[model samples]
Structures are given as C-alpha cells and as structure tokens.
Target: MEEEYTLDDPTLLLQAASDFGHHPGVHSDASAKAFLHRFPLPVIINGCKNREVAKGFFMVRGWGKQKGSFSEVGCCVQTEDNRGFGFGEYFLEESRSSREMVMEETGKEFGFWEDLWWGDQPLGTQYPRLFRVVVDKNISISSVLGPSRPFSWNLNFRRNLSDSEIEDLEGLMRSLDDLYLSPSVPDARLWPLSSSGLFSVKSFFLALSQSSGSPQNFPSKFVWNSQVPFKVKSFVWLVAHKKVNTNDMLQVRRPYKALSPDICILCMKHGESADHLFLHCSLTIGLWHRLFQLAKMDWVPPRSIYDMMSIKFKGFDNSKRGIVLWQVANIALIRVVWWERNARIFEDKARNSEFLWDSIVFLASLWAFCSKAFKGIPLNVIQLDWIAVCTP
Candidate 1:
C-alpha cells in the first residue's frame, strides 16, 4: 500500500518559479519578480534574467559591492544574460543533502564563499570599462562560473550596466530555492557542473587563467607539426602570436625600449622583429638560401612571419614528404637563428653562418627522426650525416 497524496501548493509554486527562471525563452517581467519575492528561497534564482534587474537586486540586497563570495559569483554570472539561466539550472539540479555535506566538509556556507570571492567591491564596478575586453567570442561554462579573469583577461570591457538598469532591479528573492525538495537526496559534492571538482577562489582563478579565445584563426599545422620538437613548437607558437619580446615589439610595448638599443642583435642595423629576425636579417637570409640549396629547391622568401612559417610550395613537388621536410627546415632555421640571437645577447657568444646552417640541418633531421613518423625518408639521415642524407 502506497500513501496517496497530491503535490502541495508550495511544491507546485516552486516548480513554476524554477521553470520560469531557468528558461531563457521566457521573458522575466516585473510581475514575475513580484511573485518570486513572496516565496523568498535561499538562492536568488532570477537575478540574471536581465542586466538591469540583476544589478538593482544586488544593490538592494546590499550585495552590489560584494566581492568574492556567492554574491560575487551571482553578480558576475548576472553580468551576462544566459549565464544566470545556466547557473540556476545547475543550482536547482543539485540535491540539498549533497549541498549540506559540502557545507559541512568545507565549514563555510555558500554565502561565505560568495563574500570571500567578491569581497567588499563589485568586479563590474571596478572594471566596468574593461568587461568586454575579457570575454572571448565563444563564451564557455568556465567563463560564466569562474570569477577569475582569463590570461588575456586584462580589465577592458567596453561598458557596464547603466544606472536605469541598476535602479530597476527588484523582487528576485522569492525564486531562490534549494536544488531539491524533500525525500530525494543527491550525492554530496561541490561544483556539480564543473568536472574538475571543488569550487574555490583558487579554482575561480584557474578558470580565468584557462579561459581561451576562439580557435577559428589558430594555425594548427604550424604549431602542432609532428616533425618539430615540442619545445620548438611552443617557441613557434609564441612567435606566431607575437608574444615573443623581440626588440621591435618591446619598443612598442615598453618605455625601456625607448632608452635601450632598438637595433637588431642579429643584423646590427635594422630593428629586430619577427619578420626581420626570421626572414630579412642579413645573417638569417644566408641560412634560408642554404636550406633551399641543400633540398635542391629554389625559393624566394615570403614577406610576413606567418607566410614564412606557412607558405605553400608553389612549383615544387608538393608531396606530403616534401611539405613536411620543408616545414621541418623552416622551423629548424627559425629556432637556430633565434637561439643564436639569444646566445649573442645573454652569453656574449656568436656562431658563424656555416655553423648555424649545419645546426639547422642537424636539428631538423634529429627532430624528424625523434618526433615524426619516419617512413620514406632515409634511415641514414639519423645514422650518417644529415647534410649528405637530405641532399640528393
């Protein structure tokens, strides 16, 4: 025999509010806010329905300036529209027993964490101007959930929520509810939505640090080529992204470049740049010619750094092996020249063009043998002289 009972009015009301708040398609009006306020759940559910209402609610609840706790979490999440909805769903899906266990284990209520994270000030208020700058095009789950900024997360958003929006935020408290109602308890854990486990200020920082941009423009082959060593590949990745501190880039970024010598260390005449260092430097030019000569190929250097690393061989064989060999040589040349430049700067040592060329050949062949799948290329390239092995 089962107990016969219908769902109570409070349960039905809770379901209605959760459904309304969690669905993005459903517009949140003043009436909805008024209704939710009556119930007064522990969690503020519909705060993120729109920017204005969210800010107003925070200000009214004395959470407007909250810095690092759950309020801070809620504030950050509410900055954008959809994040609030996603967060609410995750919050609602979590069971009360699990939340209690997490609270017990951590010895801090959810509000304590909120205040701890967002502490005494608002992120949007402090960096209102820089908000847009931090958010990448493809917003990920971490971007919404974590309060810490991204690697490129320098404060620079275009604008912040307006005064009218802040003024208008009202009546969001009623929708706040625990993840589950009576009888059905869920497993205990923090950050049920996050696979990494644990949600702390440090984890928030990790999330911001891990936030990355869209991969639409990422050069996959140039950075991830199998023929190059991981170290060399990383170096090239920095070069491609223009993050390497070449003299030309340094001059633009820092005031020290104005006082220091801006001339190329390799050329001693021109300004050092990714382009001149790899392509146009007098010393580097000879190395490129030597590589083409060794491969029994003729070539004219490309103008840009990207083109140099990724140029298609127009009149050459264009075979997979040929392309791989060319890129290997290209990456090797870049690595050795950059290394030579650094050696001159840091160690006060310099190598001649001939030594540099030999180093390129040795490195390219060694990396090819060690890092790549060697099938058709000669085995003697590793066993014997790479110059003799590569050249026909």
Candidate 2:
C-alpha cells in the first residue's frame, strides 16, 4: 500500500503531487483547504518551482473581488478598466474631507498653500486662513480662473473679508498670476540634499549632523597618511579631534571613578588633556624644538594638533618627494609622543627628552624608507641627514 500523508504537510503534499503527476492523494483538513483556496496551484508552483512546474498544474482560480483602479497619495496605478474618477479630482475631494474632519475634531484649520505655490517670487505676509477660505479646497488650480482674460483669481470667501484681508488677498492673487499648473503629470517628492533628487540615508545623516551648526573641517591629509601605519594614523586623528583617552577625557567619561592627581605624565605641573599632552607640554615642546632644529627651519608653535596639521608649509613644494618625507616625519613624531605617554602610565617606564627625540628620528626614517617615494634609499642616510633627504 502507498504511504499515507495528510495535506497539512505541504512538503509531503508536493512530494505526492510530484510522484503521482497530479494533485496529492491525501485527506484535506480545514487549514489545508483554506491554504489551498488562498494560494492556488499556480502561486504555490511558481513560488516553489520558479515557474518550471508542468503546465497541467498551472491553473488560475478567480474567486475574489477585482481591483478596478488603485490610487496612492502622490501617484495612481490604473487597471484595464479606467471607470473611476481621475487622481486629481479624487485627491482634491479627499483633501477637503480630511481638512473638514480635522477642523471639526480639533477646532483648528490646516493650510497647504506653501506646498502648492511653486512661484519664483515669495508669497510674503499673506494669511494662511485667508488662503484656505478664499480658494476652493475641493477644486483643482486650473479651475480657479476668472471670467475675464489675462489670468485672474476668482476667489470665493466663506466668511466676510475685512479691508486689510482684502488687500492681502489682492497681493496673494498678484503673486499667483506668475504661477502655472501642470495637471497631466503626477506629483513627486524630491530630496533637496542629494543631486539625483532621490532619498538616501547618507544624505539624511549628513543633513542632521550639520543642522546643529557648521561642520568642522576634517584633517584628511594628516589622518590618512599612506606612509604611516593605520593605527598611528587613527591615533593622530583621535588626538586632533580631542578624543584620546587622557586623564581629562577619563574624568568626563567615568565621573564616579576617583582618578587622583589628573596631571600630565610628561609635564607633571599641568593637568592632562589631549591638547596639553600633544601640543603644550614642556617635554613635547622640547621634542618639537629638537625636530625643527634638526630640519634647520624656524616655526611658530600651533595652539592645537588640528591647527598644526591643517597649516600648510609655506616654503615647501607639495608635489616633491621631500614633502612626503616631511609628512611622514611629522606623523611619526606624533605617534612616538603618544607611545611615550602610554609607556609612563601603563608600564611605569620613562624616556628622557633626548631618547624620545632619537626614537622619533629613527621611526620617521624607517617609515619614510618604506614609502615608494623613498624606496631603495639607504636607511642610515635618512637617519643621519633627514634634513637633506627632505630638501627639494
């Protein structure tokens, strides 16, 4: 005898149908009948078999109501039978009914004249209530023309208009004379943030980020240096943005933890901060002075890491290979300073100013050698005479 299977198990039903080359031979339950009725053989076969099923089972069942005309808020989808109202007329009627319902429910009237007016000039100082009352909310804009020629507003107010309101109404009509309506095209919402006028999450996020204030300039040249390692670049970027986990940042991030004597590890006289440690500390100043003296260039101290990275070198040519060495040297100095700071805090180890400056020169020479611009150059040559290597 053949194995018994119920229609409730769709897998077995499909298997039986495939075996018998027809409908499955199984007892139907209420759920199975409802499922079969809701989704016919064509739908099930098309969904499961990718329309590769035999043509014998591709039957269509028509038992429900047919859609005559489908209408959305801004656009319309019509069927073969266009035996209904146009989209404009339907939208106007629905808008008027919704306005009336809102007014009745909340005792407040809402106006959309700002949305409708697409003129080149502004509709200044006109009352929204006057626009709502004067214009027929149930009619299209093309139907608002006067009996006379030359395009006038044939307004019909529900309430008596005062002299001031009449003057404002006349100004509004003058503004509307420049407006033209295209009834054939469907309405569409455009995103002003993007060039293609399509909505995107990136554009929306940028808009929200800039809404509070002007966006700060990013130090791309400093943070995206190809000569430096990725972790060193990331650390420099954090220092530039004041996001490094110094004692001052820790105070704000963890207020409950008692971090005593929040002073700079490099210069214990001042409090520790991203700016203080990287730019203003006495030890950091000494290191910068040493690098400048080695380069034989006079420089003014910058107030912050961002200012230091953003400032352009006045006398140097940017396209020359020497500029690459200079940039790598600057980035390496920042990384070495951060390393020294962490060493003092975490390892209880310290390096004097002379040792730190030597480390900076060594690391800068090593990183500069790895760059394609400085490839095949002797490492000792770069370490001994870096100023010559950085000269155009």
TM-score of each: 0.47, 0.52
Candidate 2 regions with alpha-carbon error over 4 angstroms: 1-190, 201-216, 314-319
TM-score of 1: 0.47
lDDT of 2 by residue, 1-392 (tens): 23222234545543443344333553222223233333222222112222212212322211111111111211222222321111122222323222111101111111224222333311322465576566455432334453324655555788998887888877766765654433344333333456754433456566656764533666686569548888888878788888999999999999999788789988899999887888789999888777677656799988887888887653223555567777877887788888999999899999998898888888988988888887778999988886676665
lDDT of 1 by residue, 1-392 (tens): 22222223433554465456546665333223334445433232432346556455434432223221232121133233433311221222232211211312122222211111232322333333333334442232223333322212122224564664333222111111111222133112244324544333344444444556432345677679647767878889888767787987777787653735777888799988888888889999988777677656788888767776665553124554455656777788888998999999889999899889878877777666654445655645553543433344
True-vs-predicted CA distance for residue 146, candidate 2, Å: 32
lDDT of each: 0.51, 0.56
- Which pairs clash in the backbone of model 2? none
Quantify how close model 1 is to the true structure by its C-alpha RMSD in Å: 17.8
